[model samples]
Target: MAAADSEQIRRRYDRLAPWFDSLEGILEGLLFRRLRKKLWSQASGGHILEVGVGTGKNFAFYPDGARITGIDFSPKMLEQAQRKRQRKQIAVDLAQMDVQALDYADNSFDTVIASFVFCSVPKPRRGLKELYRVCKPGGQVLLLEHVLSSNRFMDFMMNLLNPLVVKTLGANINRETLKNVQACPFRNVYTDPASSDMIKLIRAIK
Candidate 1:
């Protein structure tokens, strides 16, 4: 069952590989960059491990000389990121890995970043626990996620339509992902506005 869940999601993403860049690449990049500029104070000169680094949209904003290692389940996505390696100043090593079961040693990174990733991770809590485990003590984890709305009307519509939305976007629209991240035995969770009940900036520590 677990394998099926993983495969199904991967297949969905694989199908969307070509269109993915055009659809979410620039628009999401703009949104993420605006928020990241505000959050750079937390991440300046940090070693970064980015999960779900689809197309490497965040690569442009990472400070010069930041050590960045990116991982994603989709091979296609990582390939898209590799295409832009030259223009970047940072040291980047990207790989394909499962978020819930990372292959790195514990406390390996100075900063960890995820954007709109956790909601569809097969196992959200375990993925977060792994993220925390990989991050060094006092190092930070950053996320930008579109989570469930608190308003009953939007929540109801989301609950009804999210399954279909997930097939298209490769993520859930109504997940309480911030709550899940906070519950994952981490510390100092903070969130900023992305939309109504959709947070754009989330930072914390392992």
Candidate 2:
């Protein structure tokens, strides 16, 4: 991702921080439950690292025995994630950090997860490289991303409405997110095709 684009996304998320929890409260169960199921099934336990963990919406679904660290660019979003944890007693090491620059040491985590996140990251490829760099070589990078639909007509509509959409949701409507993943440093990947059209569930090793 370019520096300008990174700043754009960071600024957008910062703006959305106030309503971040409420917006997630609406889409929480339906959108994230599916994400949880697929990710856990592929990679279980072992010091998990989650990037772009907005409002900690996926916290409830992670395994009780796993060690987890979650980071997001928006501090308000992290506060919301902290609020959710006070009651559930889930132990998550949360921080406000940009995806393009991870703070951990090399081979820091056994599993790295991203869900509906990379689309808004300035350099999705750069972020993916950070993901790979931090993962223990055998560990997997699980992604549950929403991509631009393959349908040309839908693509056209998405292109036309992207500006309004990004302003409203802080999301990218026109990112060919799958292609971005395909270009990353991963192998032995698995993607659910039917699910891959709009939302792709992938498991790839570093």
Models 1 onward score TM values of 0.89, 0.90
Candidate 2 vs. true structure, TM-score: 0.90
lDDT score, residue 40, model 2?
65
lDDT of 1 by residue, 107-187 (tens): 989888887788778888888899999999888888877788888998899999998987776678888888887797776
**What is the RMSD of candidate 1?**
2.2
Error of 1 at 10 (Å): 1.3
Give Cα distance to truth, residue 19, candidate 1, Å: 1.8
